[model samples]
Target: MDLPVGHIVTVLEEMGIFEDDSEPPFEHWLVGRLEGLAPGIRSEAERWTRVLRDGGPRSLPRREGTVWLSLNQVCLALLEWSNRYDHLREVTRDDVLAHVKTLHGHQRRDQPVALRSLFTWAKRQGVIFRNLTSRIKVGQNEYAVLQPLLPEQVERSVAAALTPAARLVLAAVRAARVAQIAVLVLDDVDLGNRRLIIAGRARPLDDLTLKLLADRLPTGDAGGRAPRTSTTPTRPAVPATTGSARRCKDRTPPLERLRVDRQLEETLTHGPDPLHLAEVFGLDEKTAMRYADSARALLEQDAESGFSRDTRQGGNE
Candidate 1:
């Protein structure tokens, strides 16, 4: 449970809690004292969190708000997880690794690094027995896995949409992801060839899909104003400036519905080649390949299931 600093301060002030020759009131209250964090460990984690809040990571300093809160959130969560343990020596490397994986599905880069840095600092401060961070490694993020959709799902998702995004999502399965789809300019659409040239790669757009895009194509994109730039299809950097620290993202239509279909298409048609995926999706080869591998895995699973079903049917017959 998070004890609010203001609430605690008010109660202490009202009750006339004062510093004595032996008991320090302000020093004790200022630090978040709880049963979970051991004495030295608690002070170190709390102090590091305060340091991050003031500036940035000790290793990589850019802005204050960008990295501090997330890193501190991870730090706080770690402290909370330690429970009644007196020292970080009780928290194993595996324990910290598992905690890192749970952060937004382990799809981020900085938070894990930040957590590792905390552990390193703890080790240097003699709070922990060893630097557990040396054992933990954060991997590259994987985007959405493409799964082949049944015909009915495609029809229903398209029918459910009020905007052109659903049809685009369906087309994206063969071509790219939503960001790539969003970047499509009118000049890129080759209706005559029934395909679009994206990143110098020709991806076929069927006539019906072409007509759908034509109907909903933004005038800005058509007039060569360029599509709005979107963050890469992974967790992005936190905004440094003060605002809500979060944005209210408006839903972009049947896109939500069409993602699975799109990825499946990318897999079945394009296979799991990261370079090709990068060209199509406008992602770095590594990120693109991650998606490709996921698609390939889904395809392999589907194939295995189909083989098992056929074998069972043959046995029954």
Candidate 2:
């Protein structure tokens, strides 16, 4: 009853254990296991699978004395174990060692390491948590528990998409009386061929971000039920610098513009991306870019004065 390597490989192949590219076209684990199997062990396993597939009134295969398990069987067993112990606490190395020993009906065996390998596989696929804690030590082993990302961290991670200003605007819109925030849609705010979507009535956003939001918004009415008209708005005959801020005129003046002007300038000048710049300065994409461009231009025009230019101008710190 000596198992041949080829026969063992064949059995594993039937069980889908090997990858398609395996040299012998067997399951992934077959190659590694082949070393332990006696020659011709694989042919015997192949015969077993063939008999089962033929449905020739043969008894079902038994695992009692078998050293081989198919890929599907391994998966099924792990899944069943997971479901049964879904509420269990984090598994320490010792806990895993115990489970493997118990599941395989062995005592004082290398079950703990085996269980760890299985858990590692599951953890990589996000099926289970991989905690990294130094709290417990079993035979010189340490463990950690897996947990979901915190809400605050998640918010910070994606905060780049919604600039601080955008976030503020969103907050205002959500908190404002719905009646006061009517007709919130993307539109050409400056009428300079640049478009924007109005987000909140609490305060106005600069042009770059407004344009980005307007461009990205779904084209439709509220509730996503109505189709939007495709007509583009016409450009204004004359563009006006409607905002209160005026460019600096001094060859070298003191602090000028709003308190956040320096931060805004830094954001625009060196942000990794327009969107990133917007988030850094709390402005939207278009406004962020526009501000960056404007800042550079204004500073260049007044380059003689350098960065520490005219104070008392609007937004001057």
Candidate 3:
């Protein structure tokens, strides 16, 4: 009748006929012709025939990498996923949540971090189907089928792995890659002009944050310390400063924009120093200072028009 593709592939492999070139002679053909094989076996035979006809290493053999997951968790995920979506052609969000629940076991009481790791592992293994509704909603609550690391999560992870100074160096390197900053060099940052010439390579990134980080890069040999190079030259820089402005402009009602603008005003009126803001926003101090300057300028305008106090007094005459 029918057979699972895995079992058929196994049988064919054992017989050394998975590839047509590896197929035996007339006797093999006679056996197959006389005793019609299952659909899975026939399908594999057709595939082997095409591979032999084309004959150019149709597929590269799978390689084993050192990365491993616990055998127990993997099996659990697989079983749960397959069992949930057997009738359907593809897995859905419910399938994923079901699988994650099983993988988490009693850990449901404590949100499971391993859920992402397990899904990534399954994707790498090519066992669970991909592009199967990466999002699913139940009742009023919605959950991503496979949520990746958030911007804050990435920053936290990177920060925990590196020192405060190293964090600064890494931000510049990433800024260069993402075209947020042109080049990160040992010299002064070119803000208004937007360019830098480091080591040998040159690039063009139009990011205010990178422009500022470039300014913070250490210069000269006078300090008596060896010059250190940025280590992370290819990480992605999340949109931080201009994101709010763009969102504000694009929003329909513009209330979001006003809210963002108000928050900006509050930060300027009473907030941490520029250096701390730079670190918090993953920006260079120079850029942070520029933002501070802009904030102070806005405050001045507000005071000059009496908008600052008037707004605080509920626009009273």
Candidate 4:
């Protein structure tokens, strides 16, 4: 039977291998595991493992299992690369660069970070004469650009939203994240004021959005206040609403795509100002800048297309 790491640790503790007072440190397990390696390499691995356990700038507060796995993988990779070298100190910058080149994707990016940390620590401890990875630079990973929902697609999605919940989700995603929408209660909506309190901010409610909320919510009391119940029966799950939207024959864009499309539309309308986007959409400066950049690119493409059309017409004349 495949036992979990917690179970294994418990078993070890029960067997008196670990003290009864506290859980065994991750380095202890890592040290035992590295016993098969050469004495020099094993000692180096142990030191690195201890460095991870002690928690510094290089170390993240990850789970013991994740740390153990990562440590083992890094050690194995180093071991494979260091086979020809007489000692860790003999491993040059070119050797480190060559090893890094052999990896791909996140591994290519992450391994260098680990190497830099390990070598920096080793140099500080006087274990190595020099930090081999000091000058080795790894570029940040490039993420795929998120495609916003096209105008026609957005229109089709809105038209296809048949249910009150579906319509509410479509409306809410224009100004709020799906997570915020999922937890919305009748208290968050102010139909009389035509506004919604989303993530502690008051957002203006359109007439259509107000109507959708009214249809979903229970009838108001004598004082004209909505019942205290949640907006949807599944108050904390937006999937049901999204699922309802997807029931249509046409492929409906996800709520996230709709939110992106909304942001892009706002950017285009307001002239792609990152500060304005940040304030309006509650986006960080970096994220707002990315949206602004995307909007600018779109505008430039439109201008180029228009210019080409005019040139073609002039040539025809």
Top candidate when judged by lDDT against the true structure: 4
Q: Candidates 1 and 4: which is better by lDDT? A: 4
- For 1-317, candidate 2 gives per-residue lDDT tens digits of 67667768788989989655546433444454333333333333333333333323434434422324332233333343444443223334454434444443232223333333334434543544673222222232222221222334323422433344333232222222222223343242322332223332223343333333344344444433113356343322112211101221111221122213433434434532456545433466755655555555555655675543333222221
Candidate 1, lDDT over the whole model: 0.53
The stretch of ten residues in a row with the least summed lDDT in candidate 1 is 239-248
Q: Highest TM-score among the candidates is held by which one?
A: 4
RMSD of each: 13.7, 22.8, 19.7, 9.5
Better of 1 and 2 by lDDT: 1
Writing each residue's lDDT as its tens digit, candidate 4 over 139-198 gives 576645434554567667777777766777777776687667767766676676766777
**Quick one: ranking by lDDT, best first?**
4, 1, 3, 2
lDDT of each: 0.53, 0.36, 0.39, 0.67
lDDT of 3 by residue, 155-174 (tens): 34333423334333333433
TM-score of each: 0.45, 0.20, 0.21, 0.55
lDDT of 1 by residue, 245-305 (tens): 1111222224433443444355456677777756655667665666777767766786987
Global lDDT of model 4: 0.67
